[model samples]
Every structure is written in C-alpha cells, then in structure tokens.
Target: MTVRRPAAALASLAVTALALTACGTDQQAAPGEDKIKVVASTSVWASVVQAVGGDGVEVEPIIKDPSADPHSYESSPQDAAKVTDADLVVLNGGGYDEFMTQILGSSGQGKPTVEAVEDEHEGEPAAHEEHGEPAGHDHAVNEHVWYDLPVVQQVADQVATELGELRPAEAAQFNQSADRFEQEVSGLQGRVGEIAAANQGKQVIVTEPVAHYLVEAAKLQDITPPSFVNAIEAETDPSAAAVAEVQNVVNARQIVAVIYNPQTESPVTRNVRAAAEQNRIPVVEMTETLPTDKTYVQWMDAQITALQSALSQNR
Candidate 1:
C-alpha cells in the first residue's frame, strides 16, 4: 500500500530546507564533521556514493524505506534539512525524484548536484514519456537507471568526478574507490550477460517495469502488454480488458517467468502473481530500492541469480 503525504507536509519541508540553507551556508565545517557531506535521493544511490566516497564523505539518503515507492515519495523536514546542508546532492534525475530537486531548488543552496540518469546515458536514445515498456505509456520519463549495470558504472564515475571537484585534496582517493567499484560492477555485468546469452530470446512478463532495464540487459523478450504495465505504474487498477490480456499471456504459459516487485504492492499486481503461480510459471521478485541488509552490488547479484535460476528452469 502506498501512502500519500499531505501537501502541507511537503510545503513545511520546503520552508525548513530554505531556513536551514541560510543558516548552514555561512558556517564553517563542524569540528568532527570535516568530511564532505553528500546527500542522495535513495538508498541505491547512497550505496554507490558510500562506495566511491569511502571514509572521505558522509552520505545520507532521503528515501530509505524499502517499501516506499520512490516515484511518489514525499519529502520530510529532515530530508529537506539534509539536502540544504549537503555539499553535493546526488539524485536519479530523469524525472524520478523531482521532490529532491524541488527541495534543493527551494533551499537556494549553491551545492553541486549530480543527476545520474542524464549524466550516465549521454547520447543514448531519447526517453519516451515512459521509456521502459512495450510501447506508449504516458507516465514520466523512466528514471530507473540503477538497474542498468553499465549506467551504474557511469553514475559512479560521475559521482567520483563531482566529489573530486568538490574536494580536490581527496581526488586520488575518490578515483581509486571508483576504480574498485567499477571492477565490482563489471563483474556483475558479466554475470548478467552470461545469463542473457543462455536465455536468448526468452519471453517474460513483469508486474510492472521496475526491472525492465535488467530484463533487457539479459536480452530477454518482455511480452507484457503496455497497458498493464502503464496501469500498474500509474498506481491504478488495470482495466478489465488489460487485466484479461495479461492473464491470457500467463495462462497460455507463453512466458518463462513473471517478475514482480514485493516492495510496491497493489491488488492488481497481486492478482497477476496469483495467476502466474496458478499457471505454474516461476515468479521472481525485484526491488526498486536497496534492501536494508544488502549493499547495492549484493542486491543486484541476488536478483540476477534469482532470474537466472528461473530462466534455467525453462530448459
């Protein structure tokens, strides 16, 4: 279930952020807090920042809940205050966390802001209004860049670059950390590619597009109906016709597995999962945010392993 925060709450947060910005700007770094302060929009991005920043930076993520939908997140006063005082703000800025952007803008802080989506996928295909699907979905641009391993590497590089520019004294350390992170991410890509090669052209259905990039990275075919995906993403019940179409695909066992998100729950999505199970199709759960116990790389590795196991059963 998704909770909708009141507009007044957000307005209050904006006000708090602005006030904090004014107070924080003129003050010197505190005695024990000399490290560079970095704020991220989500835990997934925060983990990357911690990896690249190592001991030289303090990273804070505003949206830390595993179950909250990042797309519809509301900022709290504490989140506003964090962004206001940050030296650098990192966000998945393909229209994903506009609340973060709004807070940063309203704070009037001159901190450096790095947007992962725009920075990582330079010269890539232009995003459709909702880029991650079978076809036309009138939602915002897809901002789930963290699922794409290649893009994650680029975002890490961008983070290192921005941090180096912010504190050039620690430039070498940042670059070194980034190199180590890149190697780990590359390993993940290799594993995913291997799975993709083994399951070439395999068809799958998703409750939503949370893992669309990952599915595509594995070179699997997404046979989900666009209407079904769009409806789930828009937080509405899929129309009767749209629901039936997806049920037909699953009932026929035309796909190898069904990918569902345990974090973002909806009645419609639950129904889809039940149908997939009834048809004896495997169900793989993917998360949009990092789990509290797992690091970014570990989270991706587990999901990839689960997907590989599911696809392997099709043989």
Candidate 2:
C-alpha cells in the first residue's frame, strides 16, 4: 500500500525509563466520580460522542483539525496520552483510523472500544433505482460511515450503549440524548429523502467516495468512473486511461454536479474539477470531517442544501 495523503507529519515519541518517584500517578479518573473520559479518533465521531455523553462525559478527539484529512491523520504523544486517560474509545474502524490502533496499542490501555463501521446497519435501498446496484455498494467498500445518515444514527445508539457500560448511573441520560439526536437527524434525513424524490434518477460525478453515502441518501446517481475514484480513495495515481475515462464523462455533460473533497487534493481530483468547470457542471465540495464552526447536523444540512441548489440549477 503506497498510498499517501497530505498530513502534518509527527515525530514518534520515544518512551524512556524513569525513577518510580519521578513518575506521578496516572491521570485517569478513579472508579466513577461521574464524568466519563472518552477518546474519539476523529471530530465527526467526537461530535456524536459529545452529543450522547452530554454533561456526563469529556471527549478528546485526536483529529479535530478541519483542514486535516482524516485519512492522512498523524498521531502524536499527546494523542496517546489522551487514549491512555480514556475510559472508552470510539473509532471509525474498517481501516479508516488505523493510526488510532497504533496509538492505543502503544498506550497499553485495554479500554473498551466501539467501531462504527463494524456495527453499520445494512440493506439500505439504493437512492437511484435506475442504477442496478445498491446505492453506496461497490467493488470497493467506502469506510466513510459518517456520511451515511442512517449509519450515523445507528452509531449514535452504539456510542450510547458503549458509554452506558462505563457509567450505568447516567445510562438513561445518554440514551435520552441519543434519541433526541436521532429525532433531530431524522428531520435532516427526511429533507434528503424529499430532495432525492424530487430529482429521482439524476446523476453526479464525485472526486472520491467521501460523499457517496450522502449522494446515495439523496437518491442521486454517481457517474464517477470507478477507476478514477478508486485510485483517489487508494491515494494512488490513476492510469492515463482511467483519467481519460473520467474526462470523457465530464465532456459528455451527463452528470449534473461534481462532489469534490477539498480536504484531500491530488492532480486527479483537480483535473476532474477543472473538467467539470469547463463543461459547466456545478462542483460541490464536501468534507469527511465535521467543520470546526458547525455541529454534525449543521455541517450535513449545509452540504445537502448546497447539493440541492446545484442540482436544481442543472434541472
């Protein structure tokens, strides 16, 4: 795997032997004074954890930088320390946050972990009925479960369940918060369903699979060439033939919009965006991580609203 993405490279922290008196006691909370310590791999998961934990838990997300690519996240000693102090850990899993695994292992903390991808609910209907294959399903599985609204809802429940295990006393509060979040997010999901219903069978081009879940949720057809998107997701350069295939799709003007990932940039993504512009197709940029300025629901609502606006123009 020679995949590479832009990252703030971090220096590996070396552990040195210290005198027994020099090392103070671990900072982890003693068996329940109330606040549960949580360590999340990314901001998206962190936001969900925070929503569920409410005032009962303190969440520390390792990759909170909005400008950073979660795929390219680099771990540091500070992140490991956070994990060491956590009562529970939440990660995207499915190979998306492999760095978190390394950090946890180094920390030697056997904290209970919750993996969102592993618990993803299945058998979702394809947004675009015209496309024979199920929406969000392909030869290559997209590990971006956060973009899948239903999956996010399911993961919210999972988080509450895991967090509740750590603090049985506040379990009811955690469940209540998750239920509220689900209800609120359902309103957003309803909006997406309505938009998809209005523009059924519409097609789109994506630079990567970051927004595939949302694209499917909106019931839009993704016409992006698999070779091109697969290469981008793999962080490898697509062959000239693969790039040309994407160019042909853009030239054909068959797609209504281009879903671009501004966080992960490459020559291929840039070329696709350039081609979309030349062909007069609207390009909407989406991110994998939650924005620093907005909550998860707000971030998702904004993206769907932008897509609706852009797609409406094409119609």
Candidate 3:
C-alpha cells in the first residue's frame, strides 16, 4: 500500500525540479500551445500538486529550501515573478503561507488560489503561527495538513477540482490522479489507525508540534505543556515557567516518547530530548518537509514505528 519511490525516480524528480525551478516544464505545453503555470507556496504543496498534476501542469515553487521553517519565510522578487505568471496557486492557508496571498494577488494575474485550512478541511486548529500571528483560534490546527491524510485528501480534491476547471480536456487525468491520491490517503489513514490503536493514549512530547496531527493520529497524547507549545509556536524560546514544566514532564517520565522538528530545533527541544533519554524514553526526530521518497502514508508509518518503539521502551 505504501510504495516507496525508487531512488532513481527521486533523483530524477530532484533534477527536474532544479532544472525547472524558474520556468515552466516543456512537457506542460503542447506544440504551439501554452501551459498552465502555477505557483505552490511550499515544497510540500508543490509535491502534492505534482502528485496530482503530473507533467500536465507546471509549478514554480516559492520555497526552495524545503527544510526552512515556512512560518518565517519571506517572499523574494523571484517568488513574486513566479506568481505573477501563474494562473493558479495552491496555499496551505491556515496561516501557513500568508505572505504568498499578497504576492500572488498583486501579480496582476489575479491568480485564483486554493487555501487548505484545518476547519472542515484538516482537523484541529493550525498548531503554529503563519507569518508570525496566531491562526485566530486555539485548537492548534495542524498547519502541516499535508501530513494529515484526511485533510490531505481534501487538499488534493480541492486541487484536482481547480485543475479540472482550468483545463477541462485534461480533467480526466486530473480526476484520475485525485482518485489515486485519495485512495492513498485512505490507505494511510488505515495504516496509521493500526499503529495508533496499538498504543492509544500513550503520552508524547513535541518540540515544535510540526506533526502533531500525525502524532494524534498515532494515538499518542502530547504531554508537552501548552505553554511550551505556545512558546515554540511563537518562535520565542520558552519562558522559565514553561521550560521548568517541560523539563519536569520530561524528567518525570510523564511521556513515553518525544518527537522533534529537526529543521527548527531549539535548545529547549534538545533539553527535552535529553530528558527523554535520561528517563530512557525513545525520541523521534523529523522534518517539516515530508521525505521525498515517501508517500504521506509511508512517512507516517515510519513515525508510528518510532512511536511504537518509544512506547515499548517507556514500558
């Protein structure tokens, strides 16, 4: 169910991405015809678009460094250039890429954009700030919606719908990709359910809450204090109280597993990892960008495996 892309294929995708970073792919346009130029706000969004659009569509990725925290990214002139020519844009809305909205809107292209937010789309509130502001709600919506299979399905659906509208002749291909993509998401949901159900309610701690939705899907209860969560979300190191509470939680063996954002890790996360180790708990380190070789489900299955291992160690 979880097919791993061959390294060769990934290498090819990477090269293709690099070569076409600033231009549309030739495969996108027919002889003497124009192609649909699109700008995806993040690499994750771009990947999802590529998954659905395949070679029929051309996407100019705004964020080249997939490892950088999208929450704090600034738009470059080049980024604006891409949006200006794009017919459509895909955004991880939930405060994930607010900077993009302005850039794309002002492009004179009047490009239509799809915002994949949590409410009725993903689940919970976005866990972090977008462009540095709270998502205007309290539930920590998983801005990393691409990691959440259910919401990811919604995102793919929205994308396919828009793509279909843009090029009706290619609607069948778009619909096919959407169907396959949705099936993959459903399969991932089942796989994650299998793993999470095995250790439901086990407590876990997150450094940045980047993949909290997947963690919750794995049935792991986050023992990371809301204060600490807020601190990391706000991009400010935790206050003394939050740090102390988090340290205590780590030291107290309050959680069985610890997961961290390797890309934007802080000393506080390192401390949490140390505490987990001191307590002999296992830790899972991950990135905001999903692995290139993995489908969302496979990547999540790997995380659950880490969780299962961590929970076993805790016991």
TM-score of each model, paired residue for residue = 0.84, 0.82, 0.79
Q: For model 2, how does the per-residue alpha-carbon lDDT over 99-203 read when each residue is reduced to its tens digit?
A: 886886677344556666532233221222233343434533467778878778877876776665556656678899999999979988999998888888798
**Model 3 segments beyond 4 Å from truth?**
1-34, 118-140, 291-298
Q: List the candidate 2 regions with Cα displacement exceeding 4 Å.
A: 1-34, 119-140
Which tens-of-lDDT digit does each residue in 160-260 have in candidate 1? 76666656667678889999999999999999889888998999988888887788779898878788887787788888998888888998999999999
Q: Which 10 consecutive positions of candidate 3 have the poorest summed lDDT?
A: 1-10
State the local distance difference test value for candidate 2: 0.73
Error of 2 at 268 (Å): 2.3
* Clashes, model 2: 0
Candidate ranking (lDDT, best to worst): 1, 2, 3
Candidate 1 off by > 4 Å: 1-33, 119-141
Top candidate when judged by TM-score against the true structure: 1
